[model samples]
Target chain A: MTPHDLKQQAQQQLAQQASLDWLSLPQKAQATFAALDMPTRKTEAWKYTPLTALLNTPYFAHTAAGQVDESAAADRLGQLGDVSRLVFVNGHLHPGLSSYSDLENQGIVTLFSNANDAQRELINAELGTAFEPQQHVFATLNYSCIEDGVLIQAPTDFKVQQPIQLVYLSSGEAQPALAQSRVLVYGAAGSSLELIEQYDSLGETNVFHNQMTEISLQPNARLTHLRLQVEHESLSQVNGLHVKLAAGSHYEQHALAFGSALKRNDININFNGSNAYCRLNGVFLSKHKQHIDNHLNLEHGVPHCNSDTVYKGFITDSSRAVFNGRIHIHKHAQKTEAHLNNKNLLLSKQAELDTKPELEIYADDVKCSHGASIGKLDDKSLFYFQSRGIDRATAEAMLCLGFVNEMVEQFPNTAVIELARQRLAEFFNDVDQLNHLWTLE
Target chain B: MSKTPLLEVKDLVAEVDGKTILNGISLTVNPGEVHAIMGPNGSGKSTLANVLAGRDDYEVVSGSVRFKGQDLFELEPEERAREGVFLAFQYPVEIPGVSNMQFLKASVDAVRKHRGQEELDAPSFMKLAREHCKELKLKPEFLKRGVNEGFSGGEKKRNEILQMALLEPSLALLDETDSGLDIDALQVAAEGVNALRNPERSFIVVTHYQRLLNYIVPDYVHVLAGGKIVKSGGRELALELEEKGYSWIQ
Candidate 1:
């Protein structure tokens, strides 16, 4: 079927389902999706990340097909250690494989399918308010097909001790399928929460994942968000995260991704009130024939707000990557401090990277700077290592690790840091020349 | 008793970036003896030192160098380092994010493994490193920081000496180790080198000024002019050259 027919089919299927109280938003979202065109190479924001491969693929909306093995689910939860977990298999919540029975007693943790009347009212009011449907087509598509997702609410003066893990596992073993997932998080005044969103696949099946996460932080609230994406080569993913901050609220994010055949993450953060802060740190690795892209936009609309960002990437073999970071400071937002830097290392002749760091400031008293650099290893540093009895290959591996480890050392969780280190070692081991140099033991 | 020299250089010619820097230079060093090479600015003293360390930037158009009955040019830079050749650089490279302790451990272990000696464990290596740092007047905390990163001029020179003491090479090439040091720092650095002297170790000290020669006395002094050894004599030759300028030698 053509791409247009596919969208019509998805919309018609959603309209035919039993009309519920939550179906109103999806109906409106369907209209929005119909009015907008799919992103292509001609689109200004998506010039570097062509959507031809994504649009041309013939994929049907996901339906519950195969069963998830209990043992396999348990094995996939390796070493995350004593934390609340919420598992979703093929866009549906699996309560049998999930933990966190007491989180609802403390503040609020309820799935959309099991939410109470009051929780449902809150979800309906705040669900699709963080982002505009007419701007992002994938987000609109995600909302048009949304079925069930998680809604987390930390009430006033409440604090969560353990991190909450949202695990999205794809088990589309029967046929090529598409999955759409949604997450809405609310932090009330003087409350805090730590959330980790993990995406994985079970078997070697062609699947496309479209995900959207909307977060609203009330005054004096704080949130720490960590997103880890590690999937099989047969999977393609498009993720969007939209966050809004109030006065005296702080939001920090760290994203680590191992690129699939195709992956893109779009993050938008806005400072809506004064005396707010945000920091974004990311590290991405792409190998073989994979492609990865990261686009971040930070908007400072009020005075006395600060934002800092840094991203590093390692591309090898025939892989490609793109990074575009833009900071916009409005005319009245004085006393704003913003900085961004992107650095990349290309390990092969065929590897490529396109980076653009932009700053648009209309305020007179603002401090904003952006820089981007792409280059290979330094020859003098390599020779310095060789003079100390280290081989060239080993020296290269050590330098690359040191470059990426500068950001990895800042991870707040020890278990995640260990996992990231192991994954990096494996990536280096797969390269032909650096195989023997990176050893975890 | 007469014995083979520890290092022998016969008519070495070297160039860098298509320009000849060393024109037929020759020198000999015996075990337990220290030789001082003094020259004016841009007189090819550093070129000779780098060429000995197998820096690929310096091309040896025609040369022959023998170290303990083996051709030195046959090995790579790393191989030469494993075979007991140490060059104390004038300007040490700063490598951020790599702690000095880790770099030193790797270097010492590689040399020990090559010489059929057991690798030092962490605790024992720390003990040895502390002793060397004490002799060099460097703080023990220097080992925890990045290698030569944000280090002062005197500190970098002392760190280089500490490495020379730890590796314990048969032949140590000191290239302008006292150029930017104050009097007290120069004394400490010279004493660090003096403490490592033994019957089985030799040193080739390359310097421009006669001030450093006062602290570390040499058995022989040679004047390198126009990339050739024009004058060679006992230690008093350094004093004579110090009284008159390098122009007197030519």
Candidate 2:
């Protein structure tokens, strides 16, 4: 994979760009893009998730279309209703199909293309700074070729009334498409905001989605972010979400991954200020040959900070899921409270889950614990349920759901919890063994 | 489902962890009959109940348990449950994440399926569950909580009865249901048990004292000591044993 060949591939992919934004990237960006093509298992960050399946297919950068079917996009998004909605098609913002107030005038929401000189300078200073581009080839690739994304900011002393949702829908009707998106949110002191990002592909076409979202919070600010990746099973997606919390700030994230043939999500958070807090929860349901990997890293850099993480996975058929969560506390970060937990349910003998929850603490004053468990359903509980007159199959289902519901029920947002539950039900419906195990009574 | 002997245990021998517990215990119960097995601590009364319930902890070495004219040991625990064998655990295990309502629904559905009936929907199931809870004097809010999580001893006992009432097992085995109950709770639980009695159902109440037997009087009383039935008599045996203690049975 020479740089010349990579450059030619990029040129061919961007040939039909309807907008000039695709060509506006600086020369350095092009050089960086050409340096990295498709990350392989050799890439440390992408060790568990191989990108060869995606690279095997030729994927072209998606171009601005004449008009996308708004109803189709709505139908997919509405599957989990009660979410504040924003629609994006082909890596371009579609404000008409989007449902949300224009907060640009209030200085709360600003498109990356619409940012002024000052905002651009701020983004340039902070963007791609929290992550090491050289180490993460996907991040480097996304940063270099990203055409447009969303930038949201909540000023100090401001509290948003509604949750901000960004829905990204990929439409590649004719060709194998690649859609790249980025999101940056900065919350000021004493501010709070709920943000949601959803990813879905409209067509059953072979496509690739690369996305990066970053969040930074100041002292006393609170932010809850929900991310859902339910793209078409034919698509391959690699997503990165980076969050930095200042002193006394709070940040919470919940993710649900249910689609894509090969999907990987990388999440990193740093507690830079004293008394900062972070909560990360996720659920991954995979079936057939789908491959999903989630890598999470949380750094307790300051004192008196607390972070809790729980990730659950249900794998069926020949599907595989990998979860790696690591927590680190600096010597100066005394009195930190952090806990990380991961559990997986294997419904088939061929299904697999590789999970690791690691903890590194320099400060002895911290209260940190990490637990990772991979086990079949508890036969005692199953027998107990069955002895009550429940059949064996239904008994198994109830116990399985109970195992995962421990964390799902903790979601503060009722709507998000319901959506996750609905997705769980849909997944269980297809799992024949689980379908035989139990149904909702 | 007849008014004859509901459960007939013959030369029942059970073991746990390679240690023999029940050494050739025998008992029989007729439909509409209540039998009380009173004994000292570790006298194998609870082991007998557990064996009847087909607990994996205890291995039945030699036994012919005839419940409603079927080979009880041949059935799985769930199958035995469908055959009307119920054991109210002395120490009910708390399932922290499973809601009580959901647990009850699963149990009821299993029983209904065993009876070749359709599963009840949410509304009907809730109605039946509520009615049973009321009969056991259990609070409706308890259904929303995890099964036995944070429940007091008496509450767990009442929940057991509630489950028994919902399932309506023919051979209900009360394993020390009166162990941790106060007088009021004991009265309520005994009353719940009394109300479930019918011509086609039978109960084997295992207790240490004669207090519970006073509330739900039994037709026959058996004194079990050293893993065997030492004496069998009318209900007066419970009072005589409570007065003289187990030294006489030993």
Candidate 3:
């Protein structure tokens, strides 16, 4: 089938859902989705990530009314210690597998399906304020088909001591499924929060996950967002994250993605007020014919704002990756300081990486710089390690680990760091030469 | 000391990038002896060190190197290291995220495993590392940072000595380890080397100056000119060369 036919079929299936008729936002989102065209290779923003694989398959809209095994969900929460968790199966919230007693008492967690009158007003005011629906096709489709989502609010001057984790699991065993999940977070003036969004799959199934997350930080607010997507290799995922920072607010995001058949992540940050700070750090690993792309855009709309971005990638086998990082400074945004760096390591001869880093500064007084490098490991460094009694295979593993460890160390939680390290080791273990070297802890 | 030498290089000829550097150089180092090889600039001092370590960039045109009565050319670089051959690099490479403690533990464990010795546990390794750091006048926290990342010249040289102390190689090749050191750093490095001297271990200290010999006196001094050892004598040769310069020896 053509891409347009698939879009029409998806729209018809989404229109049949009972929840879409009750909400005006869903109605508006459906109109926006109809007005926009599906992104192809010719699209400027999505030139590197093709939609052929996602559109060629016959996929039906996923429903939250599916049975989920309690033990399976509990087993997936392996040692993420002391954090409040909210579990979602397919696209619906599973209350039996979720634990948010302390968070509910502090009025920090609110489910969109069960939002009260006051909570609904707050969710409506800020739910779709971060992005333009006409410009983001996947985000619009996510909003139009989203069954239920989570709303996390940190009150003014409140500080959350524990992290809040949102786990989304795909359990479509019968057929090819499509899931649209949404997350809205608000940090009030002078408040702080640490949020983690995790994605996983239950089985080896063909599932497409289209997710959107919108976050807004008020004046002097702080948020540390950590995202991990490590689904089955057969699955595909497209994620869009839009964040806006107010005056004196601080926003830091670190994302670790293990590429599946196809994966793309688009992250955009806008400085709406002066003197705000934002840091975007990420690492993505692709192996065994997988494709991963990351596009990061930072807009310095106000004066005296600063942004620092660094992304590292490792690709093996015939896998390919694309990284595009752009920093834009407005005309009136003087004294803006921005830096972007993208570094990649290609492990196999067939692996490929395409990276572009750009700095567009309209302000004459801004300090913006960008750099990108894509190559194999240094031969001299490898020789140095081999001369120290380490075998060549072990030396290569150590250097590869060291390359990715720079961003992994930036994770705020130690448990997440350990998880990322384990996954990285597993990825390297596929290569015969580097099978057992990752056991050095 | 035993009659059999620990290391014997017979007419070694090596080339880097198709250009000959070491031309028919022969040397023999017996146990418990410190042999200093001094040479002028472009005399192939560093090339000889690199060739001994089995660097792939330096092609062995025609030569033979034997360590403990075994052909060193038959083994890889790591194999030579496991068989008790150590080369302290002139310019150490910087590794960004691999900590010094981790690298040292791996090296020490590999060597120990080859010699049928038990590996040191974390606590024992930390204790030994702290002791070596104190002797070398380095802060214990240096062990936690990346290997040689952002380290000063003196610090890199001291780190190489610390590795030599931990591995305890039978044949230690010091490749200009005192080139960029201040007087205090040189003395600390010389003391570290002096403490490791024993009857069963030998050293080939490669230098360009006689200042370092004041602390760790060599039993034999050889002046290399045009890739060949032109002069060989006792420790007094180093003093005479220091006074007369390398030009007079040629």
lDDT of 2 by residue, A1-441 (tens): 433444466566654333224224334455665666555576666677756666566564443352478777667664434444568775667877776555776768877778887677666666776665655666666666555667788888899767787888877656666667778888989999988777766766565677888888989999988877766667788788888888889888877787457888889898889989899988887888889999999988889999989888877788888999999999999999999999888888998888889899899898999999888887667656656766677677676777666656666777766666665666666676565433453
Give the clashing residue pairs of candidate 3, or none: none
Candidate 1 CAPRI grade: acceptable
The sequence of per-residue lDDT tens digits that candidate 3 reaches over residues A205-307 is: 5667788889999999999998887776777778899998999999998888887777888888989999999998898888888889898889899999999
lDDT string for model 3 (B1-250, tens) is 2489888999999888888888889999888889999999989888888888878998898989998999999989988888888899999999987888888888888888888999999899999999999999999999987889889999999999999999998988899988999999999999999999998899889999999999989999988988888899999999999999999988
TM-score of chain B of each: 0.98, 0.96, 0.98
TM-score each candidate: 0.88, 0.90, 0.94
Candidate 2 docks at the CAPRI level of medium
Q: What DockQ do the predictions score, one after another? A: 0.41, 0.55, 0.68
Error of 3 at A206 (Å): 2.6
Report the C-alpha displacement of residue A37, candidate 1, in angstroms: 1.3
Query: Which residue pairs in candidate 1 have backbone atoms (N, alpha carbon, C) closer than 3 angstroms, thus clashing?
Result: none
Residue A172, candidate 3: C-alpha displacement in angstroms = 3.9
Off by over 4 Å in 2: A1-38, A60-68, A79-83, A102-105, A170-172, A436-441, B1-3, B40-42, B93-98, B116-121, B149-153, B179-187, B208-214, B234-236, B239-248
The whole-model lDDT of each prediction reads 0.82, 0.79, 0.85
